[model samples]
Target: MRAVIQRTFETALFVDGEEISRIPSGLTVFLAVCRGDTEVQADYFARKVARLRVFRDENDKMNRSILDAGGEILLVSQFSLAGTLGKGSGNRPDFGHAELPERARELYERVRDKLREEGLTVKTGVFGAHMYIEQKQDGPLSFIFEC
Candidate 1:
């Protein structure tokens, strides 16, 4: 499982020109599930994201987790994150490492639910849908985690 986590001042998800989910002062997660990924990885990643200390503290230092900062999360499924480029003529991006849709959806939900269980407000984009995401990234801060 892979997650691209971005700290944001605000974020929203749009599908077919209509807003579906939104958050304020939080993190936006673009998650990808690789072949053979399991719920155990999902659970671990969810916990790690919640405890990641990317938020600034009273001392203006990056010392607060999303939980400590009282932030929300906007989770979006992004299979393309697993895309790979090969050598020579096969250099085009390939998604062979991505999990099938059914399994990927299941794992995505597990991560979303787990984060909610951790007492953080969580919003989500529609799984498998084409979406337009709008976000004002805080400090242009971002991180990538793989599990």
Candidate 2:
């Protein structure tokens, strides 16, 4: 599993011109399940993302986790994150590095539920849907997790 996480003041997802998920203040995470990913990878990812200390602290250090800040999570499925294509990850057709749709969807749903179970208010984008993910924060810190 791989994820590109961005801290945002707000985020939302829309599919077929209808809003599907939203968060007031939290991280907007774009995740992809690689072809070899399994439940163990998903579990490790959830724990790492949950403990990330990107939020600032009283001492001006990166000392606050999302759980500590009481923030939510906007999880979006982006299988393209795994696809590399011929010209790298640029504009081109995906070369089949990503997991199959059915498997990816299952893993994505699992990650979302697992995160929510960890006590964060987790919202999710529709799996396998053409959706738009909007992050409403500029200059936010971003991180990518591989697990």
Candidate 3:
């Protein structure tokens, strides 16, 4: 499992030109499930993302986790995150490393539920839909984590 976390002043998800979910000030996470990934990895990434201290503290230092900063999370399923360029061939991307759609959706829900269980406000985009995401990034802070 992998997650691309971005600190955002605001983030929203839209599908078919209609807004679905949005967060005021928090993190927007693009989550991916790799082939052979399991629920254990899902849980681990959820906990890690929630506890990552990327927000600023009193002295303007990056010292607060999303939990500590009282922020929400907008989780979006992104299978393309697992895409890889050709190893020794033409410049073509391969998505062979991504988990199948059904299985990936299960893991994605696991991560979303885990974050909710941790008491963080969690919003999610449609699992397999064409989504349009809008975000006002905060400090352009971003991190990628794999488990």
Candidate 4:
């Protein structure tokens, strides 16, 4: 599993120019399920996101997790994160590492459900839809989580 997490002041999703989900302030997560990824990996990412301390605390240090900062999550499924490039590969990207859509969706939903179970509001983009995202980043703060 691989994920790109960004801290945002606000984030919104649009499909076919129609507004979908939005979060006023929180994290926007772009998740990808790689071939051979399991439920255990999915669960691990969820727990990490819930407790990862990326928010500023009273000391102006990045010491607060989403659970302490009080915010929502905008989870997006992006299989391209599993694509391979470089070395033997040429300009064209190879998606052989990406999980098939069916299994990928299952693991994606598992992460979403687990996040909600952690007691934080969670929103999502349409699973297989082509979405346009608008995000106001809290900073240049972004992290990649993989396992």
User: Largest lDDT belongs to which candidate?
Assistant: 4
Residue 85 in model 2: lDDT: 59
Q: Write the per-residue lDDT of candidate 2 for residues 38-104, one digit (tens) a residue.
A: 9988988888889988888898888999989878999988877886756665787674778888998
- The numbered model that scores best in TM-score is 4
- Quote the positional error of residue 54 for candidate 2 in Å: 0.6
Could you tally the backbone clashes for each prediction? 0, 0, 0, 0
Instruction: lDDT winner between 2 and 3, please give it.
Output: 3
For model 4, the superposed segments whose C-alpha errors exceed 4 Å read none
Please provide, for model 1 over 33-132, each residue's C-alpha lDDT reduced to its tens digit, 9 standing for 90 to 100.
Answer: 9999998999999999999999999999999999999979999999999888776538588898999999999999999999999998899999999999
Candidate 3 per-residue C-alpha lDDT over 41-77 given as tens digits, one digit per residue, 9 for 90 to 100: 8888888888998999999999999999998999999
| Every model: Cα RMSD to truth | 1.0, 2.0, 0.9, 0.7
Off by over 4 Å in 3: none
Which tens-of-lDDT digit does each residue in 1-147 have in candidate 4?
A: 988999999999999999999999989999999999999999999999999999999999999999999999999999889988968888899889999999999999999999999998999999989999999999879999889
lDDT of 3 at 52: 92
> What are the models' TM-scores?
0.97, 0.91, 0.97, 0.98
- Candidates' lDDT values, in order? 0.94, 0.85, 0.92, 0.95
Error (Å) of candidate 3 at residue 51 is: 0.6
Instruction: List runs of model 2 lying over 4 Å from the truth.
Output: 85-93
Among all windows of ten consecutive residues in candidate 1, which has the lowest summed lDDT?
83-92
